[model samples]
Target: MESVAVVATDRAERYGKQLVGHMSRKISGEWTGQSGYLDFNGRGRVELSAGADALKLELTSDDSETERLEEIVGVHLARFGSKDGMSVAWNRKSSEAGTVQGPYSEEDMKAFAEARKARQKA
Candidate 1:
């Protein structure tokens, strides 16, 4: 399943960087200025985009792992920006439910990384 969330915040970039830095110590994460992604030891992953006024988040994982993955990310972000009142409200795609394949594989992670890079260059 894939879930997307957008949180409006003036400190989008700061919080985005903080998340990357904090999470990268344990998991695999990459930050490329405005956009970045985290690979959760091959179980699932979440991509983050820091815009001028908001932060965009997209998570992909198995149906059984959706709530767990969301909580992992949501809890960290919530604590990081608690003073800013940053809240995460995930918008999930119902059609994709029970359709996610293997949560994510090595090949999928590489593909996503390449796609993000190409988009950034454009």
Candidate 2:
């Protein structure tokens, strides 16, 4: 799978869950684990499996499609989690394109914190 596709898929899953949570509050209900696939075509399509009102989220990017997907994920998180539930997870995958790094690590976090404190003291 392409790195772009993989990232888009992961984002779609998270956005779907966030959408569910956001809608659930309106109906006073909870989301039960749903599955879906995201396709980066003209825009993008997040097709969810049966359950939770069977929603399909459509996001389009006229110029920067990848960036659009990222923005959609942000919006979903803001609407549902409101900062509390927002999080990022990294995964390793080897595809025809190449190996892709997902996100930062604990060591990276520690280093970042140390650097921030040092800068603050200076």
Candidate 3:
């Protein structure tokens, strides 16, 4: 029960593929399935499955880290054509509670923060 995070400036499809490839190469586990969404403006949710675990990655306009993950998911769909950038979060699951955790790389957080600030200024 661990997690990995990645930051990319590409669309969800491209980003998802990159994530999947990286995880497949780096982690020794069986992949299950991926379920998520992409929008007209190339922002969306990118969730993937590995064995009995689930990884949820989201991109949306809400800037609050305290916001609910589900709300962020909705916002991604609601603000499809908007110019605002998105916030992303990833969580993993295992047999034990709190087994999976994230906020992995500082650079990823910084990139997201910078993008959010730039979007706000625009």
Candidate 4:
């Protein structure tokens, strides 16, 4: 599975490390953190970098936990990085036969975006 999320912050690398570190503490898994990359449990990896206007997180995992991983990372980072509001959505990055599928088809992504907007407004 692969996904990405943009967090509203300039401290991308720092937040990335912090987020992974936080997860390691909360979950029973082995994780390693570097400058801008984190590998967790040999099953997943997260990369963080500064975008023009936001922090970007790229996550890839070897299981059917893409959506859940997105939520876990997004919610925690958003809580740490913002107070106004935060929205975390995961997009599928591939459709490989042996890899996990992402919600990236044009139609699905469109529908997902619409739904997210509606949910946020409520």
Candidate 5:
């Protein structure tokens, strides 16, 4: 499977590690510090790994579904890592995978956060 690697140049490894922890809980996946995997139930599985300066992410499943999965993961990551100006740019290498796109906008992110809050209150 192919993966997208990104560096949070201004963020520390602890930040990446903590993000994975939150992801594990939010997605109900098994986690181990800076590395783990998320089984999006039936959508797909995402493998996550983090280094001192980078986060490596990979999704395994049909190509058609990965685009949505990428958006989901990217948006959440961007939301959590917003303080550091997080941006995820998928390095698409095959035709199966759709073309890469820009990150979520501030307006979109605000809506996402509000939705999350509403869901949590439910």
Candidate 6:
């Protein structure tokens, strides 16, 4: 499965470089000024393109790993571009993949369950 997100900012290249540099230290990733790619230790991969006015991210992973990938990359991008009020809202392409994939954080799972119960009881 693949999902994409784009953030509009004047400093796209700056954030692109910073993201690649920081993420590369912990993962296998490479940057080439205008474009970068990251491998999430076999779980997923991210391709980043830096343009004059926008930073585009193409994330590819199995259905099981898509949400985790989104969260990881989204959080990092949000942090990097917070100064410009930048955040990532992923636009997923419709597919046959199930929405609830596992390996989720315990806290999030608990919260989700609680919300579900609350809605059911209402």
Q: Each model's TM-score, in the order given?
A: 0.75, 0.31, 0.25, 0.56, 0.69, 0.75
Candidate 6 local lDDT, 12-114, one digit each (tens):
8888889989999999999897999999988999999999899999888988898888887876777666556676777777554322222334564567679
Q: How close is candidate 4 to the true structure, as a TM-score?
A: 0.56
Q: What lDDT, from 0 to 1, does candidate 5 have? A: 0.66
Clashing pairs in model 4? 92-102
lDDT of 3 by residue, 14-112 (tens): 434444444345333222344433221322233432222223443332232223433433233223312324333333332322212222355555665
Candidate 2 pairs with clashing backbones = none
Deviation from native of the Cα of residue 111 in model 5, angstroms: 3.3
Better of 4 and 6 by lDDT: 6
What number of clashing residue pairs does each candidate have, in the order they appear?
0, 0, 1, 1, 0, 0
Query: Could you tell me the lDDT of residue 50 within candidate 5?
Result: 73
Regions of candidate 1 where Cα sits further than 4 Å from its true position: 95-122
Highest-scoring model, lDDT: 6
- List runs of model 3 lying over 4 Å from the truth: 1-10, 28-87, 90-122
Q: In candidate 1, what are the lDDT values of residues 29-88, reduced to their tens digit?
A: 988888898899878899999998999889998888887787778767766776565667
Considering TM-score, where higher is better, how would the candidates rank from best to worst? 6, 1, 5, 4, 2, 3
Worst 10 residues of 6 by lDDT: 96-105
lDDT of each structure? 0.78, 0.41, 0.36, 0.60, 0.66, 0.79
lDDT of 4 by residue, 1-122 (tens): 77766666555556666766777675533324433655566667777776555767788886676666666666566555543344445555775322222323456556767988999999
Give a tens-digit lDDT track for model 2, residues 1-122.
11222233334445566565564453332344565444444454433433332233323334334344544443443334332333322121333222222244456556757987999999
Residue 111 error for model 1, in Å? 40
Question: Which window of 10 residues has the lowest lDDT sum in candidate 1?
Answer: 96-105
Q: Could you tell which candidate, 1 or 3, scores higher by lDDT?
A: 1
